[model samples]
Target: MGQAFLPGIRYDKMGEALFCHGEHVEEPSQIRPALERAFKSAEEGKPAVVNVMVDPTLTNLGAISMAYAVLFGHVPYRDLTKYGKAMRRSFLGFAFPGFEKYGIPDAPWPDGWEPIPPEMWER
Candidate 1:
């Protein structure tokens, strides 16, 4: 979770593959938004990194497009939401039993923040 994959570099820290720009993603669909996002943050002078604790299968990719949100001023969040919905449906159809089936870990809600289960994740 502490490791960050910046745009335009490649590194590995603590079993996580950190990828930057110019690196090819095996699953472009998953990491594309984050790639774009990290670059946008750099361009907009907000240069930042998104620290995520996600499944090792995601590698450089995480659950949401946090990087892309920074890049396009978050205009893509709406689309990302839709994309997530569709993906959930696909997962349900395949009976993936949610991300827990993937052995993915979820971050605990911080003291000041609460976790709200998305309506769609429900049966």
Candidate 2:
């Protein structure tokens, strides 16, 4: 809930390794540095988890919500610009067309993916 991350072998592997541990929380300052390291390490291979307590929440829209992620790729008519525009208009495409069909503004992610800091949206 404190950070968003794209999935990678390191994190994915961590997820698989921790299939048994319940849950984990990460301390702050370490997050950005950890993510940055993971980004670079992935170029070579998966990053290593030096600790046993942490559990990676690997987020892969393509994998977690494949059907919904594919919805964008399937839009045969819309050009790139329009699609990007529509997606940003809401918090990560919340309430945007097609996403509603994926079940937004509803049960899960209760805020409907509304941007965390609304100020970032002005640009």
Candidate 3:
């Protein structure tokens, strides 16, 4: 899968002809900077693509995992609820706590709800 991105990166070198700026984010720390550049380029009337490299071995814990964990008591129900709420808030334009430091705008959480810390995300 990682190899598949090489062609796209080469194509982006065409620059103005493509009307798009491309960034290859190879590490976690690169995410914000790449996204910032992409946004800046788009704001200047050019489209942008940030090709973020992800660890293929890292399994995502999504809805299925949440349900299984809650049902099997692998994770506390309240914890998952908090994480779910945080995700919902992010979709609604509120940045999760740590993400705010990366230039994402932060909004107050609804009363009684706080974003679960990033350290708890995979657990």
Candidate 4:
């Protein structure tokens, strides 16, 4: 089999109206500045395209595996009701505990229901 190579394009030569077509900003804190710059350029008749780095939990395996564990005998389940409640919380709790900070409210569980602990993430 022959090797394959991808050709790269020079977006800079596209002129001011298409400025920053392939720009990258590494840090989350840098996103605001990058967006501001892009907006300013666009306001001045030059629109920019930026690719910002983000951690989207792309590799976190939780949902299906957890549900499976609960369904089978790998994990203990004394009370189906309580187990279901924790499983419900596990969907977001295990993967997105910090979601509340992003303005998306945490998943609401029944009152007095114990939340799935962080230890769940370990498995």
Candidate 5:
């Protein structure tokens, strides 16, 4: 129920075996490129981190789910209602006994936001 703050540590100083290319993706548009960079680094036998930053306001299940859909190219849903249906399915799939009563909101992507291309998932 409480949050803790830890001072940041430099990744490069962790040791050679753990050296990694750290990429911070702050928006949906940057995700694919960041992932590609990480993959290329990994392919070259280097570690990488593609840290996709979700909005701080998205603190609930439904909101975070919608963010994932949009950030990961699952969106461009046929209609708004479909998003609610998807949320309902997701909620039912993961809801536990005491958490079953939480409502699933019709969360939608922001206006003018674009989906990551399907090819991003490939390779």
Candidate 6:
């Protein structure tokens, strides 16, 4: 199968909507200006869409906290290992079907990462 490419942004308005074009705005450097303009319009209660071209090399850290919450839903400290095993199986096992023995590498934290305190997870 051929590699998929990003589609070109369409500029056509079906009816009464105004369409603003950001020509050749397909780089990480071009995102901030587009966001600024979109936010300004949103603040003023105007309909706006910021069509940004995402660079794959950039780690999309935008939803890190939310994604973490979803993946490990309020897991208690005592059940960390259990939840961790489930997550590992769900993500890695399915990727390598029938390779149950494929080991997932240890996390790359040199000094070890701090665990979220148990008190925080009690709620």
Off by over 4 Å in 4: 1-22, 59-123
Give the runs in model 3 whose Cα sits over 4 Å from its true position.
Answer: 1-17, 61-123
**How would you order the candidates by lDDT, starting with the best?**
3, 5, 4, 6, 2, 1
Candidate 1: tens digits of C-alpha lDDT, residues 68-116: 2234333322333333433333333244445466553343222212232
TM-score of each: 0.21, 0.23, 0.37, 0.32, 0.36, 0.33
Question: What are the RMSDs of all candidates, in order?
Answer: 15.6, 12.6, 15.4, 16.0, 12.8, 13.1
Question: What clash pairs does model 4 have?
Answer: none
lDDT of each: 0.38, 0.38, 0.48, 0.45, 0.46, 0.40
User: What is the overall TM-score of model 1 with all chains considered together?
Assistant: 0.21
lDDT tens per residue, model 6, 2-49: 111235643323111564322334678877886776668667766566
Mind giving the per-residue lDDT tens digits that candidate 5 earns over 17-109? Answer: 467778766589988897898889889988886555554323344343534444434432233334334443443334434223555343334
| Best model per lDDT | 3
For model 1, the superposed segments whose C-alpha errors exceed 4 Å read 1-28, 56-123
Model 3: lowest-lDDT 10 consecutive positions: 1-10
* Stretches > 4 Å off in candidate 6: 1-5, 9-24, 57-123
TM-score preference between candidates 2 and 5, better one: 5
TM-score of 2: 0.23
Which residue pairs does candidate 5 place in steric collision? none
Error of 6 at 71 (Å): 8.6
How high is the lDDT of residue 3 in model 1?
A: 26
For model 1, name the residue pairs that clash. 7-21, 8-20, 8-21, 37-67
**Tens digits of lDDT, candidate 3, 13-104:** 55536768988777999999988998999999889877676543333444223243334444332444434433343443332354455553
Which residue pairs clash in candidate 6? none
The TM-score, computed over Cα atoms with residue i paired to residue i, of candidate 5 is: 0.36
lDDT of 4 by residue, 1-123 (tens): 010111343333343344444456668888888788878877887668776544322212333344543454333333223333344444535565554565533444332234334333232
